[model samples]
Target: MFFDARKNHQRLIRRAVSAALASVLIPLAANPAQAASYIRVNLIGYQSTLSAEAYLMTTSSISGETFAIKNASGSTVATGNVSATSGKWGSYNVYPISFTLSTPGSYHISVSGTVSANSPPFSVNTTSNLYSQGVANALSFYQNERDGANYISSALRTAPGHLNDANATVYKTPAFDSNDNITSSLSATGATIDASGGWWDAGDYLKFVQTHSYVVALMLVGIRDFPAQMGASSNSDFTNEAKFGLDWLQKMWDDNSETLYYQVGIGTDFTNANYQSDHDIWRLPQADDTYGGSDSTYQYIRHRPVFVAGSAGSKISPNLAGRLAADFALCYYVFKNTDTSYANQCLRSAEHIFDLANTSPGTLLTVAPNDFYPETEWRDDMELGATELYFALQSGGLPSGLPHTDPSYYLQQAATWAHNYITGPNDGSDTLNLYDVSGLAHFDLYRAITLAGNPSGLAVTQSDLLSDIANQIQTSVSQSKDPFGTPWAWGSSDTVSHEAGLSIMAREYYSLTKTGSYATDARRWMANVLGANPWGLSFIVGDGSLFPYCMQHQVANIVGSTNGMSPILSGAVVEGPTNAASSGSLDGMVTCPPNGEDSYKAFNGSGAVYKDNVQSYSTDEPAIDLTATSFLMFSWQIAGAPATTP
Candidate 1:
């Protein structure tokens, strides 16, 4: 999960005219069997103000080609010439094209030439129609991912799940086999705690604080940044959903005893076939509490086991401590005015936990089976924790339970950590996904320096910190190999979400710097996720006509249809093509792909091979961490992303 920070200009103020330009891709040995033309586009609506882009792919290359945007009634609304062909993609010659339509209505892309074809019907709509629905659908994904008594009204998911997580048993982390399955029986700690009301980490029922805390922070940050877009706290909106995760996090963090429980339930247990684990069972989540089977086999499923990070009062892995602290500190900001008592509790937890960060860290704690998450760095996590703590302290009063400490102390700490992150080996390693939060931390710290009247003792200057985020975008842009202008790598679909966040962070600094390169990046990444790609598929479910129907999620796979609309897992973003598929299945589950057929194999390329099958976790598994970024990205767009000047 590390990157070789591609070197770029030392300053973010440098014009990225060259970074914005891209070259054509010619598939040298691409097949030439298909003769017809195909138009690839974003099936979901685009913002009327932004120039919508698509790809015209055919078997033959040509000149003097013109394209038109036609309304639902087949009337021409906009026209442009495809003067420059964009080389080759798969077996087709590609022509990159763009058009603008200010009018809000349904439309389609059309080419009037020798190689003529029509794109799937799309829309040019308002930001609300284009993004708000996406955000709402994303929230539905979270709700469907929800655990315990509080539940949302969904067509497929009606019952509450994992209610028995309340008063869940505590267990020691078990040893795992090479395949990441538990090898033997687990030992209980002779204790119990209420560990209910969080999200299921992914397609599986097991929950991990490693993934949960990251989701909680993103939700809280969205609630803080886009208060208007998130809606009222009274409704089942972002504030309510974030608070749901926060409440669960509070349960995980035993403040009185300084204990941090990091995981719940066990993974696959193939070593002892008699014993079962979360992955070994593939049923709706609600069935666990009411399971009808031998207690010895289903005990782990019905009464899940919780795993603590370490013993009470022990120093925590900086990764967990930092994010846990940030989650609460942001909670203090979001609720300080309306809910003073709750905000104080959040701030108090933040103060106590941030104080216990393992500054000189070794092995970072991600999941019990480290192979599952494989998080490498910790400084980025701590930097965000300190910066948000500083923000909470900068806002106003201290939590009543804690001793008095100056806000400047945290500000300097944040700066020092930011400096470490910038100079550290992982400086430009990643963007704002669950693993790397430096993109977000840098954005806040830059402004926090000014709020503190440009403190002289800080370790990093505003210029150094801002350039780091710019470098992340620079790296992604430079590394882009996809015909859609997105960088591709193994397990890179979520990386698109991360890169989109980096661009949005750069845009958040626009009023201060007045640059627009990141704005274009923001749109480009969104397009890739929404649908514009070689396969003409949307990585996010329920966003467009053509999206994943057989996601590996239990709820979706059990009750959902293969047709993409029988109560689809709306707004769930999945991991995309890693050029390989890991096909799998369990008993009593709907069979996806019917006979292991590779439906889209003809379109497979060097690093991109996407499958919409329940067995394919590589291309179909939707997880909490994977979908977290989409919530923020969609909200930012729904709010117009504000500064649009280039």
Candidate 2:
């Protein structure tokens, strides 16, 4: 595996002896404590084409700290001194520095003083493909998240689970206590649907369409928007991964009956033991089939329950219907040329699902235990769903399965929804994420109009869409006053990824007008997650030297690594940080926080705390929704660069 090879190479790479740049040495009254000096860098390394940058941070501020770049052979390639302080973030004075490394070799930046500072080892890549291995690892994460049989061996997966989903019994949505758990046995709808495959929503086995729809839309969106990098033409693995998601989504939506099943399995509960929840158990997915508990609870665990948003053929919740419509429509756009039959199926489903969307939906149906994923925005989802539907229909001639149709109707619907998004209350509440996608929808809609002779017939104009995109990005930029140039929101790692995605959209969308200010924002946000943030740790597992070793993911802890290295969950991104961090333990979980302490607590400040421990799901849990945007971000970077070097 490339991930294993990369780790092995790190051990053999030659490191040049550190040589410091000459400095005046008229600095401090006393020696600055080396314990307080540090260099935070992008642990995954930098693109050779981009100026390699890092920050020199010190708790006890000192001037004239000489720095040097050492290559594999312990020879200094570049040297400099900390000229001035950039600014104070948190408790340290940060010195932002940039240098060039033209050679492709192992290298690191170090400072010269009574007690010198050295950064975690990083590589300078001259390879045409900088993030291919990262992209591969990201895909591996999806493989690890896979549910049902037909599983292939992956970096950390050998067995598949949730096979019961193949012919899973359908259950009516159940009432719940405050914690989003099933309170009683669900009434069977006298139906057993083929709800197999797709992904586990997070570390747990429970799945939901609220998050699944978002993942599928984003995956297909990446393929549609950045085809070359995603290898849509040449690479089949990435396509298959997206198709894996599309297939599961199709099962969730019964096209012939206009039914949309929104969730599967149950979550946390204390009162319900007869039907024990997934969170109540700590084990692998394969163990679910034979799980034993008092009161014959394993049947519910074995034959997982599926829940629908509404009755069959009734107006589906706009959020699910809209996003599902977008997923199917995007499938049509992506597969139309290669597989006409499957593409036609996608188009048919897209049209039918979009038609079932309740445009005036209030208290939008998400998942049971409504607070878990309370989505308030639907117009953006409808806008994107309608836009992609329009794209599917604009393919000149309808496919064998598709009959004569007017594409303008969907386009009009897309425009109206876009207008509703702008005039709606949720406009600036969130950026590009599971709950919000207007940042992407508006950009694509703007491009579509611009490419079609600047369409003057839409309910919303190109100017309106572009302005919304700019405002969304600007709003995020203005609110990001933390150490890193990111908002550090709930699910902060995903926010970091989504912000980068938004930047990519802004960069390309505004390039047409040549005034786009998002030139380096994408790289900046990417850096925050890769490293270069307050903790000097990569949020992505297996991508860098320092990352979350004790992620809240049960699979990683129960069967994966403990030393923060390979055989560990590769490419899963942790929730970076939140205002209030948390932790928990299961009955049979491994003893993580091996040292019995949050090693990263010192760096936690600015109203957010991050813990690389199993307890802190708020900060270290890896979720499918969090990993989706990172894939988009990495793929777009590859598209901007060149061929992936896997």
Candidate 3:
């Protein structure tokens, strides 16, 4: 998906001013009917503190009238004193006013002016705080999956053999720089990081988890959604596509795409007719003219080989090809719990991938550029690979010869590394060594607990740790507001831009302990960040690249066609924040999470509050991943879990 300026753009900055200054235009417009309109302020690159002149144009003609700017809740934050001076041709003056949010919440502005009797009525259409609301809904959906309710119906599950369209887009493509070291393409859209979108293929296992809970519903949906052609397709096509997919995976492995190849990027599978042409047919749900070609090298890397490989079933390595399923499980369990059968399959698969990670396939242990982590990194592929093994161990599949003690030792060692950092004694400082988001490394502690077998071993301590982290995140959210109460993406760091990761972390915390302020904080962050869009709606930007504006992809409207109804998980469902029914509105499009709450919240001993509203997508509301998380939540509900109150 792509966007043009008017289609998607916004900005902001703040500071103090004693004297009157030139008012900046709050460029805005709206459709005659129910449509949202607002002036976007770009604060992403703004300095931490500063205030400036702000204005709102309410009338078609400059005249002796005043307009006011209010917080999204309709509280007057600033009022304009009109000078009897004619302004621009068709703009009313609401000028030289100052406002600040220096806290967390949504800031909404409305301008009213006394206009000529023949002119349009005095009305300004806008809303705020919807971002937070949207996020809360997304989080709630996630919590449900984490607890064990299938929010995404299993009816959408891809039958066992073909590539699920949900996980079929290539986020990043394997290419070669002048050196032939295998460079990667983020996406043709120019987003070079997976965070922006493109190349996130691990969603497959997430659907699998959701399916288990909503088996009947999923089976039914699958029967309706899966094409009859898939059932009638030649069985050989499945094998062929599988092989092609493997070769593509191998190329990715050979290339240092990210720290891990991560099963990211669009998939090329020929088992089904939709994707089985002589080329790697990249089909999105609604768009026509599938991407990918048979050409070897182009301005960007090419997927033609993948297409050819799919048709021939000649390119995949048996060992690597066979391991894809397990890899999927490892990725899913990072946040989700798993069952025995899935665990066994994942274990066998992980063992092989670990081997492949450590050694070139068919070769001895040798470090390479593509290894998931660098040898120099505190925890490299060895520890990380072991971590996957640990999950597999918990799932009940013990590998043939690998001693249980070995994994145990690795977990212990990982704990030691984490403990050393958290204890902070080495730095001779009173603060925990793991004070920054770098401390996110501590997430591994959860992995260790899973491996410890005695969920009680570090359970109590872990709950405390999570609470402590949640508090810090809350504090960050609180301070993020300018003096008025609008939450900024981050207070001091650029890296901690979105709260998606934090939401995931907080939800995970709640899942583990169901105790403390975790749920409250999780809900709060969701409310303020992702859920509280001005229209009180939420959206899912597809797994493609995030645009330059930093906002998630905000769909103008839901698809109204059968093509739109297909069970595809791309694009976010965005809600406007200004709905009167909503508690409030947020400042941006669909709300997104601030990136580094884990680090900031840890240092501050506080996090944002929990608040939220509901959201709507097509009949296919939450994507597979979101639905899987909902299932997890439902599971917890069924068990009647207790909540953690700090």
Candidate number of the best lDDT: 1
Regions of model 3 farther than 4 Å from truth: 1-345, 351-388, 394-397, 403-407, 420-475, 482-497, 507-518, 529-537, 541-646
- Range of the 10 consecutive residues with the lowest summed lDDT in candidate 2: 1-10
Q: How do the predictions measure up, each by TM-score? A: 0.91, 0.89, 0.38
lDDT string, candidate 1, 254-311, tens digits: 9989999999887656477676677776788889986856667778788889998778
| Candidate 3 per-residue C-alpha lDDT over 15-124 given as tens digits, one digit per residue, 9 for 90 to 100 | 11112110111123333431112222321111112232232223343445454545546676555554443222122222222333333334444444343111111112
Kindly indicate the candidate among 1 and 2 with the higher TM-score. 1
Task: Identify the superior model by lDDT, candidate 1 or candidate 2.
Answer: 1
Q: Which ranges in model 2 have alpha carbons more than 4 Å from their true place?
A: 1-35, 64-66, 81-86, 113-115, 126-128, 181-184, 232-236, 270-273, 293-295, 400-404, 487-494, 509-517, 641-646
lDDT of each: 0.75, 0.71, 0.27
Query: For candidate 1, what is the lDDT?
Result: 0.75
Model 1, position 101, has a per-residue lDDT of 85
